[model samples]
Target: MKLKTLILAITFLATFNLFAQNTYVFLGSYNRDKTAEAIQVYQLDTLKGKLSKVTSAKDIINPSYLTLSPNGKYLYACTDTKTPNAGSVSSFEFNPENKSLTFLNKQSSGGENPVYVSIHKSGKWLVNANYTEGSVSVHPLLENGKIDSLAQNFQYMDGSTNKERQTRSHVHSAVFSPQNDYLFLPDLGVDKIRCYQFDENKKQPLVETKSPFTKTDLEAGPRHFTFHPNQKFGYCIEEMAGAISVYQYENGTLNKIQRIYTHPDKIKSGFESSDIHISPDGKFLYATNRGKENNIAIFSIDENGLLKNIGYQSTLGKHPRIFAIDESGKFLIATNVLTGNVVVFKRDQKTGMLKKTENKVKMENVSCVQIKRI
Candidate 1:
């Protein structure tokens, strides 16, 4: 009996050590031209805060945003961004051993300037939102990670109070609810959150729920959203208003609970909040403010699922567009698009603060970053 117990202990320790050692970083950028490589993979040195380039995938233009499959075997990205009538979503087969991405297939995004792509939890469906054209496209995923033809497309025709920025529908992101039964789309032009019930068993998976959409503050221009780890709360960053709108989530509905501005008042950057994320432990939240603010707004989550502004940390560059926290919540990396720099930060678990490190990488027009441990 003692020998068997000793063997079980050894197996647990081995698994823990293996998990602690493997971390990979994926970055997407805007290509100067079609010949430039746009998607890159790097081996992240967690201890030394270094990024070692592994391989880069080419032949696709402006692969700006990226996401991985549930099993981490595949990667998908929005291609040809800012190119009129040429937007697409492409898939790649990722091999962890060789640390390479093999091009697979791509499907038209149904609209121009496709910005964000997300896969359903079941891994059977993939959806993308077009920013400039105000449209959403859905494609069925084949078993081998190849993207099939476009299935359904929805074009939104609406606008909000801001005449210059919100004169037409601009869908910024498509986020699936924690339950995977609903999809919440933050439309910057319309100033609303459109909700759709997803039935994966049917050919037409996206249908409007009883509550079709929720209205945001008149000129908020809701851009990106995230749900709390506990699944009881939701938060969205308003790009135009420069604030976060908090909501209570249930089934497929969002009830507004609180709203808070992310940055200090009267800054020169004027309020260009970009990305929002909650720590893995659910204790803290972080957001990036662009337009010369170049800082991350830090907040602590209370038990009641509300936020209290703790402090702000400089991203060490300008135009901090998108930032991501690793699954372990030990590190955060922010990408400054205009500055052509990606800066790393170590997170303090107890204080919920970020300290910048010297580990930085130079890449022009770096738009997005994601970290995952394999």
Candidate 2:
């Protein structure tokens, strides 16, 4: 009887693995003219790196940025006008089986144009960064994955040297540390990363850490940040200067170690760098450059967290605003807003490079791409 029971367990595990075949990729769009759905879902073929359209969430105006809950059962998005003093954050309950989203609730993002949202690893708190107003807000999550009332809000008043783009503070992204003990808010207009100690237990959850902030190069316009999986280093992609700043992170403090340019010296146009991400294995880093060089810049990370530029790949579309790699690192999807299409790329895991795939889908005003293994 014991032998029979062991065989049954092994058979069940094998069946489960066989049926888990696809991953869900969510694409968020700006929906400027309301002609396109705000959020579109697709099923990624794990083996072939192909994509098929799933259902989409409509009537969501300008859902520019999206974040999934830690459990993957919910999704949160920041929506509204890019102009100052308007916008909201919305929540949705996600169904893993059918890959569908049910709208849950929304709340004022506390400022204008909330461009980014991040959930705490503890699954109890949600944070948002408002770009136009240069502010941040914290909110609580309900038991059912719905967002509750706002908890705290803070605004930054300072600006940097760039008169055209840096006339005022512009908070672009807020990312929590690997341990969930700290939060980093990268301000594009001010050229600094605001460090905060995050404690969900307190009435005021986000407080200034021992090191309140770290200044990047003047006019750098730090836009997005990604932490190394090793938890020892972090990278901030600068928008205006088209550079990546590497830092050593320890207990909410950041020590700048290296800075690398994303574009070649000859290709000098107005800078419009967008996103940054590191591979799951912590071996490679990727940054997106938009202005004249519409490409994804690739870099290799060394043992000491320094970066070496490998090369750049054209996105094949205009304004590759955001892109995401699958968990298996087999494919990448780039959402190009100006071209109104999504492009798929096959990734060479051995050399950390990308090859354009034949697959392309037309989507209106695509802004962000996020992938989750189902």
Best by lDDT: 1
TM-score between candidate 1 and the true structure = 0.96
Alpha-carbon runs more than 4 Å astray in model 2: 1-21, 33-35
lDDT (Cα, tens digit) per residue for candidate 2, span 131-159: 99899999999989888888999998999
Give the number of colliding residue pairs in candidate 1. 0
The backbone clash count of each candidate, in order, is 0, 0
Global Cα lDDT for candidate 2 = 0.88
Which candidate has the highest TM-score of all? Answer: 1
